[model samples]
Target: MKNFEIIANLLKEIWPEHHAKLTSEICQLSSDDAFLLDYIAEKIILIKKDKLKQAIKNYKQTCAVIVQEEIHFRRTQSYRLKTEQQADTEIYSNSSFMDMYLDGLLISQLFWSNHFKVFQFFCSSFLTQISKDDTLNRFVEIGPGHGLFLSEIVKKLPSRECLGYDISESSLRHTSQALQSLECAANVQLINKDIYNLPTDQNFDAIILSEVLEHLEAPQEILTKLSHHLTPKGLLFINVPVCSPAPDHIYLFKTPNEVQDMITSCGFRVNETRYFPMTGYSLERAIKSQATISVAAICQLST
Candidate 1:
């Protein structure tokens, strides 16, 4: 409660126009769900309070860019991020920019309607369903930015060994700090490594790749590699945004079916799927208008 109050106050001060709406949306969350977000805010504030205001401002700027690009996409039916070179130049090499971007994203996970709802599906659906399996003892998350999913994995499956892989040391560091702040890093190993370089023989019972697909040039390759890394019966959770245009997003998925098709093509069978359209838009309206719609899928390797 205290942490939520402090962070909410900070957001209100930094972005007064959006704060009331954020508050209204947050009030709709179940008490337990609300507490989890508050707890996350506490850890983030403890870790980045010094730069929190700037991060909020950066998020505002990031949203502005996305809005402009989204308009262009709707008109042109093309994403501005067309090549790997652009992503490398604009996103991967810029350390300060990435820091601000990551900070804003962490806040978005808490306050953004679609993002929060997708995470809720992850918690109530995917995680809950997987928790039924007593044999699931090992877990890995690719690009676990902000450590929310990793921490939740540890909390839900305390006995499972957890691994988080990310190419950015700063991103991994933030995840580590977040886990430690939540006092759940004991079973987590944060590795500064890329998925392509991971040992071939290593496998996991569950793998999480959320919001990372949109950043890749060839998502199919990564998904294929992940399939190789998953045990035969392993479950994989993927979250991607369709018709979403962001500064760093490269791969453009046009529909939810495209996402599921990609999964199937990569050797995974879609077990369950959930869609969360952007706030203020219904699923049908979002699809018709080409608005951002998040697709969260739970999958397993095909026989």
Candidate 2:
């Protein structure tokens, strides 16, 4: 059986209630994305098979929590992410809690339709941009949680120098282990540093900031910093969720336009933008219902 099939069976056996919905989403995956998901499944089996069941449980529970939070958001029109200090104390500082959270998030990129589509957008749009630009050689991904984006970079653009930065040592370690399992860590450097501490003189030809903006207290500051670090002809791929409520998410983007405006105002000229509504919600319906929507944008520095 393919790794994805094996893991699907495992999820079915453990979470029968979610089987039909998950199977539907799996069937909707494109061939390339399905392959990428299989690759991730194979790595999980190799590295964390003993903990796979628990991870799936965590993912299911997290989904439930998000559903409730989304309900609250719909009622209040505000996200639960009130402050960074709360996130630091309640989510980031608790190692065991983060272990479960990260494990669930890794699975989310595979099964969550919006998350999967955002990754697909990154793979198609960002990679195509870099492949056509010979000058785009150096790559950096800020807050490369789970190492999926960096793995794609090192795999497709093998000659490109790559860097991954995270403020948490444990998060960096998790990302490193993920790359190591895929055997793509040979050319990728994982840095234990805050985004502000990144070397000012070092500019990169490509930068990826996926699902990171929502976690920050001031996302515009990081976006501005990224603009300064990008090469004159460099491209950036960034993903942020609108109306998404999570334990660690701080900044709340209320709509796709809001997300786009924030990026454009932060010294970027938007090259392309794709908005992916969560599964079972159409873009219009999501907007009308105030549902979560993932906004993926490809940008260049505004001259």
Candidate 3:
């Protein structure tokens, strides 16, 4: 809780006007969730404050690019990229760019109000699933960029074994270091490989693919593949951003319903859906203005 207070004080210093609201929201989190969030905040604040600040600065610049691309999308009604290869060449392969982007994501998950809400939703939802089915032991996470969620899983489910697959070596390294810093006894393996390339015979009790679908050209392909890799009663957690334009974001989901439908079509039955809009905006406002809204869902194989 001390770390949460530290982060709250820092946010208050940065944005004095929202100090009360930010402090109040931080208070809403359960003690364990608060500690996990504080761990991320502490890492961002301790390891490289200057680099994190630079990342935040670059994020504003990147938003300008996103704005221009969104205008093009509005006119064309389509994404700019036609293939995942383009994203790999332009974004993922650029190590320096991804380092900055991933650093920005870590900072955002801690201080960005909307992102914080989405992260809270993810933790709470996962806790609810564990309560129902405490036997979830084998876990796989695709695209574990920041590793905060994976670390939380390891901390909460100390008995589980986790495997994370990511195309970016930078992401794999970050995940590894994050989990190491946590010092948890949970078994973890971080591999630099495309999810599609992983063996098909291995089934997991829980699978996580958060904030990754929009980066791919054919998200359904990955979803369907994951569905086949899930144990009979395994749970799948997914999160996507609608109308959220970023440098690497190729596919676009226009509405929350579109995300749910995509999952259902992939042979997964949606059990719950949660949505969070950009800070200071209502869901309707975010939708009307084509602003960002984060959507998270829990699903299982359709019976």
Candidate 4:
């Protein structure tokens, strides 16, 4: 939603730097270079700008293509790894928030320190889905582990300017690095603040409560605090793992339907719930019983 005049001014500022880089490459050519002789210096500058402009346009198109291809790739492989994770989840006799945090640190994109490419790719795909829908802007994510979600948001919707809050200092450190790598780092702010200290003056276009609520001894407190922080007309995305066991899934919602009720009770109106097809449970049984591994939703703010 930016004016062309503003964009024009930005292009003016950008052109100088672009020209400098373009010319720098030409400067490397020897004076005896046949191509340089064919065109006058003035024409060379114009051609350089023209080529640079073409490259920029191509890069934008390439990003879109890459996103589309990635979506297809994820859809194809969703089941195999999902089942593998579920089998691993069953091995944990007891898990806590701290354990989940550590596990995520090792494998989740939220933290760049983990040096895991697959997790980073997954986070990017997740954000791509969330951002394509305009309703999901003005975002805030709670307990975003290493901030992988923030990094993806930074890349996809630089105009949105998201903020994230979590209780762990180490997690915040890694999240900062993850966002910075995506070049959308300016759009997000990470705070080592608790849910009780949730900022009230700021309003979000979307709220993300991913995997953090179930770890809390009082999930209601987190939900209510988030309810107050959400924008009156914004979207909320809450993700909870269902049948899949984890070290930190101390409290369970069993199904997306159950979580929907809890969200409605807390004053938010749930609009849609999609169960992430999980492994271990037979597809037929999971569909009938409504027991899946994860829940993500689009929600409307409650009055």
Local distance difference test, each candidate: 0.85, 0.84, 0.77, 0.52
Backbone clashes (count) for model 1 = 0
Residue 68: error of model 4 in Å?
38
lDDT of 2 by residue, 209-296 (tens): 9988898889999999889999989999999999898878888898899999999999999999999998889999999988889999
Q: Per-residue alpha-carbon lDDT of model 1 for 1-303, expressed as tens digits?
A: 788778778778988888888777766678887876776677667656687777678777777777888777878887888876797687767888777778878878767767877888888888897799878888999999988888888988888899999977777877888788778989899898878799998899999999999888899999999999999878999999998888788899999989999999999999889999987789999999888899999999999
Best by TM-score: 2
Model 1 regions lying over 4 Å from their true place = 23-36, 46-51
Determine which window of 10 residues in candidate 2 has minimal summed lDDT. Answer: 40-49
Q: What's the TM-score of every candidate structure?
A: 0.90, 0.93, 0.84, 0.55
After superposition, the stretches of candidate 4 with alpha carbons farther than 4 Å from their true spots are: 1-137, 280-283, 287-292
Tens digit per residue, CA lDDT, model 3, 62-86: 5456678778778877678767888
- TM-score pick, better of 1 and 3: 1
lDDT computed for candidate 4: 0.52
**What's the candidate order when arranged by decreasing TM-score?**
2, 1, 3, 4
- With a 3 Å backbone cut-off (N, CA, C), the pairs that clash in candidate 1 are none
Runs in model 3 with CA error above 4 Å?
Answer: 1-40, 46-78
lDDT of 2 at 183: 85
